[model samples]
Target chain A: MNIRELILNPDNFFKDLSSKESSLTTPFLIVLALSVLNSIYTYYETSIIFNLFPPDMQSKMSIIMIFSIVSSFIGGFISWLLIAGVMHLISMAFKGEGPFKRTLGFIGYGFLPNLIGSLITILVGYYFLSNAQVPTLTMEQLQNPTVAEEVISSIIPKTMVYTNLLINIAVILWNLGLWTYGIKYARDLELKKAFIVALIPVVLFLIYQIYGVIKML
Target chain B: MKKLLIFILFLFFLLLINPINAVEFTGIDYKNEYLEPGKTYDLWVIITPEKEINNTVIGVSPYGVGSEYIQIIKGRDYEGNLLQSEKGVGHFIIHIKEDAPSKDYNILAYCNYTKDGKKYSDNRIFEIPIRGKPTLTVENPSVINEGINRIYIKIKNKGTGIAQNIKIKFEEGNNIYALSEGYIKYLKPGKTGTVEIKVYGENSGIAKLPYTLTYSNPYNDLQLVDKRETESRKSKTITYNYKNQKTVEESGNLIFKIIPNDAIDLNVKDCSFPVGKVNNFTLSIKNNYKDSKFTVIIGKYYIGNNQKTLSINYGEIKNITFNIKVEEMGVKEIPVRIIFGGNEIERNISVNIIGKVDLVLTGVNVEGITEKTITGDLSNIGTDKAKSVLISVKKTERVIPLRPYENYFIGTLNPDDYGSFELHAKVINETDSIPIVIQYRDENNNLIKIEKNISIKNLINPNQSQENNDYIPLIIGILFIVGVLFLLYWNFFKKNKKIIIKNNKNNREV
Candidate 1:
């Protein structure tokens, strides 16, 4: 199925895909593309935050950028595997049957929305960081957790944080929708069971995002 | 018989001599009994005969002690005949020389007459006294037209005798009045004696003083003379010049000029000034003279020109201003001396200096709890101006000064003027008050400091209470999160339930 059909008629597309041979190649390419977008967004966001470090630590920003990009690239695939594993295990409770490879492939496709969200967040963050006045801190000040938290929070604009939170919530809901149909079709589970399986992680992730927005306020 | 014949012959001889002596001097009449030197007098001699006589001639001539100084005129001797029981008159014109001494002199009167065909001659001597006359004059008569003026009138004796018991009586005039009379007991010839006459004049002008002088005449006191002329008393009217009437009446003295009561009126117009500031002091002066110059001095300050001269026109009122900075508080009297026409009038002007500067804080507002910043108004309530005003947070046990606004500087504050000041401090412990210090300089450059405590009991700390209790944004955030979640459920699960149920029914029917 094309990207338009997968996004518009995800239930029918995933059900038709589940009936065919489940190949990991397209799913792997999708996950790799999402990971590459996540890494680019993380690298940009981390580079802006690195300005809060002292001059000596800021000189090592290249190393910090590489590490953060590699971790976010790897973390994107791990998050896909974790979501598929969690959904498959929860589907088993309802006596749902699904191959682990098919569940993982469906979960990798769920991250396509995250790639768009990351691109939008990176654009918004660039605008925010361009205008933000970040206060430089000493090593001793950075050691203090409270001082570090205050400095970080002050540098991050509240509007950017709220906007990113709303974008993330929308993206998470879209992924949940795709994952609901993907799990229902690939695991051969009831629609209610798949929705229940999707709602848990989405609700928890939304709670976390709302708590950060409230804390920022 | 021989004794009777001799007695008859003696009696007959005595009787014949008696007829010859019958034409003796009965009395001498002269114009003056006392003859003064360089003067002429007429003397009349009367002679009587016992029987009728014809061709009687009588002549009088000076013959005694001072007769050398007396001369009888040749053509003025009387020559006439005498009758029985009638008197013959002899008139002589005598002149005393300029070098005559003052003494008594005798004049002889001789008469030749024929009685019963026989020529009889008789001579008699009359005494003439010479004495001096006293002439009095006044010298330098002048007076001041003020209260009681003591005028010294020099009484000069311009005669050849001693004048004694001289009494002078002053007559009142139109402008000048006599307060008392004058007396000089004795005055020698060509000598001058001063008599003090007390007088007062109501105005300034020439005053005519008519006076009568009475002195004892030594020549009249020594002998009785025929009353011809009296030279013992003199009457004269003297003119005395009066000046400075207004000056004398106003100041009661003559050492100063005539300054009218309204000539220069001085008044302290404004004295409400501060202690240390250079302020303008106004003095109102009204001039009543015809464009006169005056020097005004207040305390140690001189107004106007280099010599402190101020020229003002007639009936002109001017306000004189000078700078004054008083150091003390209270009502002070500043000595003022106004000098005009070489005279000085001293006066005292009271200046109420009021009080000094006092600063108080109002509308004090404190912000943070740990780091507090106080802002309020500082005012000067006194009459003085305060300069270089500074307000700072005082360091205490529980309060410490902070940065940015530890001390606020306010340049100046006048009387009843106020300025805003802000101070920042760090509060260590919970306290109800924050200490602050205010410093300023007075007009005299005296530094003054005041300490006060600002209450912070009613102030709310935004960092603590405001941040914690502000839940409106948090509630909105929660509501937004719940709405997003409901939308997600309805759009992904609730709305797709019909499609899912239809798919399920198609699968079951197949």
Candidate 2:
């Protein structure tokens, strides 16, 4: 459910794609739908960002929540289609027994994993949000000099930040795996050549994520 | 649903890249919601039970304050009507105007929460105190003349909050060796309380003497504490040299002739007063020469709006009086004093000059029917006490007549319990008298007479005729007639009426 692992394993992403047949659209649509639902629930939890600027700048996480859920949902779908379809197209243009049927089957069944992911995320986040108590920040507590830092450092662990960093790296390696697999499943490339190509997407995404976490830090 | 999805998608994109906002609470605290005179505190709203609770749900939480001074600075239900704003991390900055009444306030947050799409907005209570400048009063602290003993200290809270962990000591004269030992507890707003310190020797003789006191309220949760000091205390001492025959322990007691003797402590040393134009006059003495050697300096003083003081030679004899001249009009209060080492003795004596006064002793002669003439003579003093005058005369047995220096002429007299004759003129403006100036012409060609003034009790008009001789007979005749009428009615008329009534009643019954 944490999408973090999914982003990190390029070989598994394609291996997932290989076992089932799915169009770029179905799993993307499911992810988008789940994301929308998540956003509505987030808004319910955080209300809206009302006082953004000017005199009072009190914004609810609801605004950010809605935006993140929606944009990420759409972007995920788009990215899924562009990468999968282009690789499929590249495979079709090349030689021998381009088994579109089996490939589509592999992709289609692979959608199940993300659907489970979305469902899990939605359920966990929703249940938590619904039952969550809005913690009151005592004016004194807020003004206490060390409480904020103590709370932040204590809650968000270094592993999470580092893992997120790794996820970006994994994004590139996964693309490389898929692209190399295009040659293997559709063009029937030799195992050695396909294995060499599988590592590219994870590397690029890794570089990008390095920039990301640095900026974040 | 599609639009909602798009909105969600858009949000997801932004979150994937956007930075979290910082929550700045610009002094809207009642006390900062801390209840300041002009500033306000924000009511931070956030997701409940969120590990990082920096989010506030709009239109949900109910905020209320217990104080009348709580006003929403901006961005609340209305622009300026009790405004509460979204400060990131669940804090809102509210603005309150100056001149609001200080009080305890409440902000209740109310909102509906939906887990699995179920919604409810419940209320929670938050307390804020809006306080004015805390009233400061320095109370007389309980002092053990021991370590850090405070002769005077204050309990002070300059703000509305309870001042906690207040520690203070007499900054200059604290007997305590270290400050950590001097700890005074909390104080409330505008409240007064005492702090006892035994930082000094509680059993020492110095404990009885007033000392400089100072203190501070470190925590604003209590009342303001003021410092105490002996320097501002009022005192006087009366010291004197007894006949030198009295014991040191029995150095005669003193009485403030005008004021109560026990009203305050007095130190007596060598002091003096000025009489007439002469400069030196004895006022007090200092004779404390038993256990320790001490010196006394006599001084002259002038009292009024502008008081003046001058001291005599140190270690001088106890009975020495100093000389000093002053130029002033009307009533003058001159405080004569003696300062021995640190001991002081002072007394205020008053004198007046340059005013108008007159006096008379009156009696009348009956033969002439004229108002009486005053035959007594009186001298001239200042006008101040002259009007409240008294005069006395005694009949002489040998008639050793008047002389200029007989020392008996009348004059204004200062109150004297030990000196001379008595007569009081307290009630009225004037008293009338008749004096029989008795004269006797003996067989020889000589005249003997004595004059004595007798008071006239009545001032009513005197009638020409004496009517008692004429009215007595008339009154006697009227009395005789009334008696005869009473005798006739009782003996004849009453008896006749009784018999007639009896006869008539007997006939009617038959």
Angstrom error at residue B354, model 2: 41
Model 2, position B455: C-alpha lDDT score: 54
Interface RMSD (Å) of model 2?
Answer: 64.8
Off by over 4 Å in 1: A1-4, A19-70, A88-101, A116-170, A196-217, B1-445, B448-510
Best by lDDT: 1
Assess the local accuracy of residue B407 in candidate 1 as a C-alpha lDDT between 0 and 100: 94
Quote the lDDT for B88 in model 1. 70
Task: Please write out the lDDT profile of model 1 over residues B102-215, one tens digit for every residue.
Answer: 777777778877766777778877787777666777764332433456667788888666788887776666556778877888898889999887777555444565666777
Question: Which DockQ values do the candidates obtain, in the order shown?
Answer: 0.03, 0.00
**CAPRI quality band, candidate 1:** incorrect
lDDT of 1 by residue, A103-205 (tens): 9888777777787677767676665555555555556656777656655665664555666776777788788888888889878988889989887777877
For all predictions, the C-alpha RMSD in Å is: 30.6, 67.2
Model 1 TM: 0.38
Best by TM-score: 1
